[model samples]
Target chain A: MGEKIMVKGTEAIGEAAIRAGCKVYFGYPITPQSELTEYMSRRMPQEGRVFLQAESEVATVNMMYGASSVGVRVMTSTSSPGFSLMQEGISYMANARLPAVFVDVVRGGPGLGDIQPSQGDYFQVVKGGGHGDYRLPVYSPSSLQEAVELTIHAFDVADKYRTPVVIFADGMLGQMMEPVEFPDPVDPSTLPSKDDWALTGARGRKARYVTSFDIDPYKLEQMNLVLQETYKKIEAEEKKWEEFMTDDAEIIFVAHGTVGRIVKSTVKMAREKGIKAGLFRPISLYPFPYERLAELAEKVDIVMTVEMSAGQMLEDVKLAVMGRAETPFYGRLAGVIPTPAEILEAMMKEIRR
Target chain B: MSEQVKDAILLASMPKALNGKEFTYCPGCHHGIVHRLVAELIDEFGLREKTLLVAPVGCSVFAYEFFDVDGTVAPHGRALAVATGMKRAKPEMFVLTYQGDGDLAAIGTAETIHAANRGERVTTVFINNAVYGMTGGQMAPTTLLGMKTTTSPYGRDPKREGYPIHMMEIMRALPGVAYAERVKVSRPQDVPKAKMAIKKAFYAQLLDVGFGIVEVLSTCPTNWGMDPVEASRWLEENMVKEFPLGVYVDKVTEVMKEKGVK
Candidate 1:
């Protein structure tokens, strides 16, 4: 750890992106994540970078398409509704194979819901938020420091795979402050050039073109196949999760992001009560660590899922468990965050059955 | 044929800014004409190496393959927004957006208005063909009143389909706009004037002035259900009535006059 400083999750992400060498940021202001945009606006231009407040969420994502096509590191942050509006651009960028980072500080959704923290966008983010056959490598962080680390790592993974990466954080994380050690700033000038496909001016070379329109069906199919192969490589190499005391537990709880942090506390409380409980947290949600969860599910008597949404990620947990154990979900819907005590009670109730 | 080719001398060949590929435009389409004019202007200004074209998702979606300069295709109606990002990030690169009527005046109206209002150092070539050619002749926002289209089979009614949008007039009113012109490519005489208007727009960006736009009255012969020759005549007779030609804004010239330069 370097010099420790306290920052909100949003601020931590903004600083991390700068450290990760993001030179361009285009975003529209929204609740929960506005601080990230605000910080970028104030600091990016002063550092001789581009920070533009787009006219709308739609325009903001399209701007990323343009910036990334020029081989520049770029990022954007938004809440739920704004994230929804960006789905079309996300699909386009995915098809065009442009790399950029997007952070969704999730709030209660299904409409113009409350601006409070929620995990409702799990299905949308992990199961392809946009149209077509594509996936974004998603990261869900449990703390401010982890958000910073994962945010910095997101840029690397996105650039490596040439795919968009989404940081699936919640409003609670965005608003809460915690002590974090900042990483060393990356020299943007030292980054590798993307001349292989970037839309830099074609002076003495063949013109570089970036587009998703394939009029021929066979060619489109081949393009989709290429994307799928890349995704398969990512899944084979990048499935990450953390298992806490799951080796000797009879009952396990699966969760992620802010809810996972709460479940960790619940596991400690349940252990003191002589309940053999452990927590399984998935750090990468899209290429989820299902194999580890499946192994634990076979050993445990029950696998309980906890979340801030009604029960979106519960389906994934159940799918991983594969009928090896009793899979039950307990959640607080529409921005209601459950306490550790409430989660313990639900776990006890489910284990009793 | 070889003797005739030799006698022609190839004095004025295709502009090098254009890739050596045959156009995919339909017969009598004005996109071909506008593409040639823009390519010649890019060649004339020696911007072939520093230009980036953002083509729209209409009939020009494949324009990246047609231009020998670096280019990308924007989503439907988002050409200006993408161009804004490119220009702002790489100020040394001259960025341009090529869009049609539906893209500029309808679905992308917000992007078009906001980019010009911000005085982004970019140029936009608006091809107002008055119909959606790619989607098979739907009524466009720039379609003249009483014009027949697939969506307006009974002829467009002003109360129902709305009046033709004058992009040049609208863009000229923005203070950040340095130049705005409405030109046509219906006749051989119009081609030179159209090329001049396009070159002026490109110059606005090269000089780092405000945003510039050139609205070209184009034709969609197949969509208009007319032959190539008849479509040209129809545009000269009808389309010109609602969208008149000439420069509507010339703030670059105004500044030059103020500075007593040219």
Candidate 2:
């Protein structure tokens, strides 16, 4: 077992990938995510791997594109606008069905909004962040330890589905230091055989071919159908949501990522007041746990969706409820992280309403 | 599972996978010649299994069909980025990006400069034809002065659109480039010399030297509104004058020679 140590969430991600046999790291410097790149730049070279500081956000993403195409485990980390610049590369990765891990340490943003911790990229990440008809499995981790563990698992999920997977966390998780006990690093040799395809030289296997262009609409539609079927399996198997103090609750609050931390404290305060409020925190944003929300909607009186952006995840919550209950939205736009007391007050308003 | 072919690739034999489809190239398009050159090097270096080609927009976006190994298509001007992701994800794979003027020069300028600037282990094959062929002859970033096209119909004046970009000079200027050269497929006679240049560039990357590029000066007869013979002749007289042929930077072999490693 590796010795226990205090590490920043960003550094833990780099260490985990290193143990997972990740051979290459490429990224540009951006606030909120500077540590991930900086950590990798120092560590990867020591591990006898490639670590490059790309010239720009676009170049960094493309460098990621190049490295991933050759069948190596690789990644890039960035804040909002940098992540926005990577949308095009992300879309191509999704379309090409290349397995890769992208870490978005989201900061506040409409455009260069601020470097403060924020979950404003919920919609951009869970939904396709690029201009394409696709979805990358997105994992949101609230804890430092989970950030490390989830990133390793992200690579496996990406390879299993032949899709890009994002370990979605924010500045708070990336920036703050914590005592992290990481699970065993994923062993690459034990993973599934991609010998049937992958460009790392077609040696010893039938020449593997991969491309996104399907001139035939029927073929493209078929590809989408196959992808949808795979995503459905993920939705059923990987949809994760944690419910806290839901028993005999009056108003149930749905939150994700950093918002869940605030909501947890909010639930405790409401329990003290006998306000009977609870929290529903989504771990997998893409799988969404919509069915769980629908099931919970029947027992709860009011449902409130709390977010860093203006109620992006609320749309999915409302869709899940399907008018079974009124899904009220409480959103704090970029920069200001919703506080526990602020969320409790908002839930009280929902209970009064 | 690969079936064994009797002869080794180093014996100057073509791989069984290459379906000899007569190339679909504009007359004198250096892409076809460069494709053959690269294919030959892949055969020579026994890299048919390990090398993957990524073709970009402009005329040869369908390069996936031409190369017998694994290949993928990227969105316009995003080949370098796509290539980056591919190489990063699978480091052992020998990746090469084949890009043209409009694709690499104008839109993908950032990607081009930075990939070299980063000295990515991947080799780049830059086809520097001066006009946009597939988009029906527009003002390519490398279009010569006074060169007429659909967009620059009244001839390209330096004052209006700026002079044609000399990519080799720019690539040479970057400290990160291991090798950079301007080669031409202008005359059928110059084919071997062009092939030599391509092989050296690819070999540099194969040995993990650094970013290497062989800019193959090409022609588009239809876009240039010249006959096939005239296009090649035009490249010899005009294109060669503006973009001089020879190695702009020979750092790759020099490094090896200095160490007596090769």
Candidate 3:
């Protein structure tokens, strides 16, 4: 709380994860997120931790799954395409109820689109990217300080729920530098022991099994029911968002991550122009603060979403609004970021319409 | 009842490592034998309490049900990679992966190669049955030339279908591998020899040597359209030609000699 220093977004996230008691980091080099991997490779060994440059993203995520299965703090960082490759492993972890953190510094995508920030992976992350009925508690941080705080929070959330948690910052947050203060380092020994479910040699006890395969249809359905119940609990307890000037506002701007910060600036711009505008920033994508958005929709005349995608989050926003308000969307697709002026212009037009 | 009990004398029995569950493999399948050998080694090494097995996705997907030790199942061809994760995370435990040819030689080729290349101190028990057992006898990466199966109805042609992948030979060349062997359990005489090879692979990991694998040449009679006896004979007569038996790597013996372990 007292210290301040300049740190790259990726480095801040990595350091914060370390301070949160992460003992193993397995990752491959990928654009916009390579600095995070490099940071771990340099710092983990100093902390007496494991830092491995895996053969591929496929192997890296699987490695993370293995490490996490043993009840250890393990993680991996990747960009969009690499995260796409990690989908199978992520599903496996979720199904096995293994706890781990995954950092997706999302870049332009659909297919290796470009190396720039994009909230394009919103659906892929918030919605399940892999097979099965699974959800990763997604954290979208708007700044380097938020990235640090969210990363530490990610591990705790993952461990507390015994499910995989994701930090979904895009390229802009990963590559940009900002002043941040990391929390005090955590002692790995003090963390909860995974002996209950981890593969730590079943000495003097019944052997433990970790797998997602359930051949019987009835049994598989029951397994999914169990997972769905967990998701319900998460939705009930973990929905987080920041409301800015929503009171007395006629038009509300819904955004997250870097897009949310931009919309905050645009809200000021629109206010200066004598238009009533406010910002709604969702911190958690999955377990999304949909109820709040719904509440705000009833009060606001227009529910607008601004994104760095064609319009992924708009689907969720509209679903939340459910025709309570007129839903309008503005986005710059394929790695193009929306400026405050462009967003303000869109907000003004929405108000005028 | 006393007289009947007296008449029953046990010569050899199942290893204590088996959980007494019946195998899900088809009749005449060699997975039972291979599983027994692994179980025997687990019993012999006293690794039951300290062993973690990674079961692969083929016919042996239910292997965790048979082994008494703690276990996990990996996606197709990713058992070794998963084992690498388990072993790295818990180095005190002895980790072993049971994978079929399709899982180890085909889709998991990259994982198998890299786990070996990185020299993860783990043991791999590879079952090379030359056919995809669980999915109904499709042509596998190790499926022999001219072999007829569900996918290769016209027989596998080397030019079109490619030759059987000799995995032990391929893995032997990797520096990370401390020991690699291809053994067969086609006949009664071969069972003990195969068991010995599997034991050596386990010892390699216990000694912290390197990655070790024993590619067991197994039979899939249900897929091959042969009875148990015929399948055994067939493996001896034909499958042996494609995947010749013997050690492909032997640093375990070298390490044992250095440490004065007999």
Candidate 4:
């Protein structure tokens, strides 16, 4: 463990990326996440790395695609609208099987929604926002320390799977500050070699090219099948979640990210009121802890989902519960962050029903 | 007779930087000529083993297959932005982008302009063929004022569609641009000049200066509805008059002089 330092969430993510051997960062300024870009602009030069403020999110994501193709670690941070603009480039990088990382500090929006924090981008990030058959390994961290840890882990996951990894944070997380103890900086030289597939000038080897295109439908289908296999492997190996006091609980609350930590409070409130409550928080949104959630649903009479959006993750909770438990949802829409008391009251209503 | 046959010498052949595969371009399309020039320059610079080409989303989309160097295909109009990332990440490697008029001047205008403005140390070969050949002769941004095409069948009207965009003129205005030139291969006499401009553009990167671009006024005979010879003549007469051929910016020589080299 390294020395503990107080840091903002976006800046901590930037420092974590630098420590994780990220060599290049291309980004465009958007609210709530611009500090990460600003942080990189200062830190990358000091580290003898590349940091460029792209003309737009469209350009920024393509730049990531370019840098990643060269077998170097690259990343970018953006808010919801910028993330929306990056979808096309993400699809390209995903199909090309290039490894890269992105941090979407989600802000409110159907379109230019306020800069307030929101979990509105759950479907956009976990479900394929980009046009294609692809899945990104998305990590939702509940605290600043978890945010720092996940940012570093996302890079390794991206390289291991040869696909894009996303750190699904939000506006509140971006603004909040907390003391974080970072792991030691990774020595880039000691990292796994990508020379076999990386575009390293093709010297002393047969010329190589990377592309996601195949003019023939049969060949394209084969490529998609390979992608599907990768996703299946990831789903099998990467499901992660945290269960708090669920060993003997009758009601379990499902949540993730900032709302997840808040629901921990809700769990405490419910337990004090003698309702036997617990919390289940998903860390990996794509390879969701479905199997465990289903098992927990069998033990609990009610599974309640709380979110900062209009219950987008509720659909997944329902799918996991599959009517084994009475699944109810409580959500605050349009960038509203619900308090623990509100969530506890909502849980009580479901219990009474 | 055997001694005479054995003594025969080879004068000219294909460039080694180019893979021996035949091009898919239609007869009289200038993409073949431009590809040869680019490959020859890579060979001349001895950069074959240290080059990365960003292939565009046009007729030259398969340029990666043609060039015997490491490369990848960028989505339509994002080649320069992609190349910017490549060059920045690996400054030691020579990066280049090959884009057509539609891909560069239309869909990728922002990427092209901003890349130049940022002075990214990458080379760009822009092919201004006045029409989108791959998509069956749709009117491109560089299409002539009165030119007829699949989309502009009634001849381009300045009222409905804007005038032809002069990308070289745009490049000249950018402070980050190190070299910007407009050339052509319409006439046999113009081929060497086109190659020279391309070489200068490549030198802008090789010399560690700034952004470099050479807009080659090319022809698409099939799309232009003319025979090969007629199309060449038409490009020379019409496109040349609209987009004047010359060096729009030349910071390469100044930088070379500053480095105390010829």
Candidate 5:
């Protein structure tokens, strides 16, 4: 354990990336997540690293592609609209199999909706947002401490799979401050060498080339199959979820990120009223813990999903439950956050039915 | 006669910096000429093992296959932004971008301007052929006001479409630009001058001064509806008037003098 220091969620992610040996950061300023870019601008020079404010989000993501092509750890931070602009580059990086990390401090959106926190990007992040067959590992953290830890872990996953990783935080998490104890900085020199695939001037070896383009349809299909295999392996090994007081509960609430923390309070309230409720939180949104959730659904009578969107995750909850339990959904839409009392009331209605 | 002719000295050959792969360009396309010039400069600088090329999405999309160095193809018009990242990540290595007019001036104008303004230590080779060649002859940002193409079948009119863009003029105005020049390879006599401009652009990056660019007024015979010789003549007569050939900016020599080197 290292010394605990107070930090905002966005700044903590910045420090965590630096500690994880991120060598380059290219980003454009947007609301709620601008602090991370500002933090990198001030800290990267001190650490002898590269930090550039790109002309726009479109340019920022391509810069990430360039840095990652050379086999270096690179990252960027953005809000919803900015994240939308990055979809094209993300598709390119995924096709090229470049390892990189991105932190999307999601705000309300259909188009420039609001700067307040919302999980409205659930569909865009969990599913393939760009124009292709690809999946990015998404980690959603409920608190500032977990955000710091996951930011470092996301880098490891990106390198292990050689694909882009997303830290799917919301605006509330970006603004909130918490005491976080960071791990020791990973010395970049000590990290495993990427010389085999990285473009390191091609000295003493054959020249290397990296690209996502193949005019031939048959060859492109083969490339996509390889990506599919990687995604399957990740699904098998990386599914993560948390359960609280579900051992003897008759009802369970499924939620993630900020909503998951709120449901924990709802579980306590339901338990006090002798309703026998518990909480199930998913940490990895892409490689969703479907199998485990199905098992829990078999044991419980009712599975309720709560979210900050109009029940985007509910579709996944329903798929996982698959009629094993009676499924119901409760949500607050368009930047509105639900309270524990309101969630508890919603759970009571389901029980009464 | 047999003894003297048997030991003749070779004057020129292919550059070692280029892989032996045959180019996919059409006959009389100036891409082949510009590619050779870039490769020659790479060999002269002994930077073959220390170079990274950011290929753009045009006829030169397969540029990585032609260059005997580490490289990647960026999305259309995003080459300069990608090169900026590559150079910043590996400052010890030489980085360059090869882009056509549509990719550089039309789609990627912001990336090109901001990268030059920021003084990113990377070189760019801009090919101004006045039309998009890969997707057929479409009207380009640099297309002449009276030129006709597949998209602009009725010769370009300033009332409907704007006048041709002069990228060299834009490059010269940027404070961070270390070297900017416009050159053409239409005539055999102009080849050496084109090579010199490209060599100076390479030095701009090697000397760690600032951004460098050389716009080559090239021709696309197939799209221009002219034979190879006629296309060359057309480039010399028309493109030369719209894009004057000369050094627009030359900070490389000043920096070289400051460093006390010739």
Candidate 6:
């Protein structure tokens, strides 16, 4: 209920977390996400909470793990390469089923990827980028408002699933300024109690064991089975997506993160040209809305997957459609942010196909 | 040996798991014995539930499985970082890191030095068994001169690779360490002394007495191509001469002495 003030997506996410009652901010200053960490560096100390510029990305995630283990709302933000460095710790947190927010502002490449924007980490984020048979609820936001909302939802989903949650963004979304409004600050007291798992100074209870240990081989396997079942429940219950005009579109534009925002403008231009084009944005990357995509595939003739990498999400789009519709792809690689015109160009190609 | 002498030995005998479990150390390897001693102390002190053991990745990647209580497997040489996180997060909880010479002195050198330098109220259980045992007994920073291992098959040349690091001297240099002692668990007679050093390290974490390390001169019989008996003897002769057994820093009662709100 207020006029919009311009803010970078990264800063907006940090401010949103602070408003959402996050107590600890642990991060290493990497490109793109540096704005978020800088915001925390200035604000967190004043708020009388903990803010640590950790030794490394690995240490940063571990710090988030430590703080999260004790029931404090904590988060760590980084980019693609830094997120790669954090995979082991992220896997560790996933195994422990710790609820903490991780923001991966994607950049390009296999190593020390470029500091500029890219959506190369879509597969990594959705597939539980760590070395474990585990999954975290990953949210891909299109705009500054979506970034804040998705980040808040990421924390909630993390707590609900008792697993790590990721707010997957790109450098463009992180650096670009836009207006945003936070829903409401969650009261720590009102939040769902994690008494069973959290190692807080709560009332009488046996030492809440937070470990990935089941001594017996059969028992460990059974534990893994149980985790898998829980993941299934998440996939079934928490799939969120947004559709613009999939009702009678011959061609659909499937994209996410900042690329999704660009896709929207392309769809509008395609509609002006009398071409049937629609936008499908996957808000949750994991527990991916495949069922919905398959249903929509029946209605569309061609589905064009647009991403900032050499066609990573294209494979997922194909899987989601499962060959019901002819799925094609377009990509902008290595720190290249796809413009609306570029996406429109891709959409025209999709319409012709 | 009379009944009273036998009873004295029985009372001194370590319990299981403090006898810590299933160490993958080679024969003549004193790490197993020393690890057992740490476990025994933890068992005796009833610290199984309260203690957070930080096991580094060198030879102890799966140590979390052996440790009964909450055990975190830290990255190579990053046991200090993991322990620091645990200690800072749970200020009231006991945090101790079990590290090897290679892990602490090599890649993780900075973390080990900084944690000690900062007096992070974390205890380090430094196992200074002259050579790296897991990766085919290669020369460690603490490897004694002329000690033949995989890396130094032609004997450790002081001219090329410098002399062995004196950890006791290094520990003494750091102001954070409340206690740093070089002990060898090669002999049955010396196991108790090694346990005492380990116990002090554990207690230092319990009492918030800053960084404490117990450097145990372990023997690896397999690497030495000797039986357990000979390796123990080798440790006494060659190892003890290089890393002379003694305390580098001792302020076990510093917490009790300090007149301030912790």
Q: Can you list the residue pairs that collide in candidate 5?
A: none
Report the C-alpha lDDT of model 5 over A207-305, residue by residue, as the tens digit: 988888888999999989999999999999988888989999899999999889989999999889988888999999989999999999999989999
Against the reference, the lDDT scores of all candidates come to: 0.90, 0.80, 0.89, 0.93, 0.92, 0.77
* Candidate order (DockQ): 4, 5, 1, 3, 2, 6
TM-score of every candidate's chain A: 0.98, 0.95, 0.98, 0.99, 0.98, 0.95
Candidate 5 per-residue lDDT over residues B15-120, each given as its tens digit: 8888879998999999998999899889878999999999999999988889999999999999999999898898988999999999999999999999999989
Model 5 residue A156 lDDT?
92
Local error of candidate 5 at residue B149 (angstroms): 1.6
Real A-B contacts recovered, model 2: 0.74
Error of 4 at A164 (Å): 0.6
lDDT of candidate 3? Answer: 0.89
Instruction: Look at candidate 3 and give me any clashing residue pairs.
Output: none
How much native contact recovery, as a fraction, does model 3 achieve?
0.71
The regions of model 1 sitting more than 4 angstroms off are: B1-11, B254-262
**Candidate 1 lDDT by residue in tens digits, A1-353:** 48999888888999999889998999998997899999999989878899999999999999899889888899999999999999999999999999999999999978999999999999888998888999999999999999999998899888888999999999999999999998888876767668888888997898878877788999999989989999999999888788887879999999999998999999999999999899999999989888989999989889999999888888989889999999888999889899999999998888777
- Pick the winner on lDDT between candidates 2 and 3: 3
Every model's TM-score: 0.97, 0.92, 0.97, 0.97, 0.97, 0.85
- Candidate 2: Cα lDDT at A45: 86
Candidate 6 Cα errors over 4 Å, as ranges: A1-6, A19-21, A65-71, A192-220, B1-49, B58-68, B75-77, B131-146, B150-179, B187-209, B247-262
Candidate 3 Cα errors over 4 Å, as ranges: B1-11
- Which 10-residue span in candidate 4 chain A carries the lowest summed lDDT? A344-353
**After aligning candidate 6 to the native by TM-score, how far in Å is the CA of A151 from where it should be?**
1.8
- Best-fitting candidate, scored by lDDT: 4
* Shift in Å, residue B38, candidate 1: 1.0
Per-prediction DockQ: 0.78, 0.55, 0.73, 0.84, 0.80, 0.23
Candidate 2 lDDT tens digits, B4-52: 4443443255544354566888665667667777887787677778777
Give the range where candidate 4 chain B is weakest over 10 consecutive residues by summed lDDT: B3-12
Model 6 compared with the native: what TM-score? 0.85
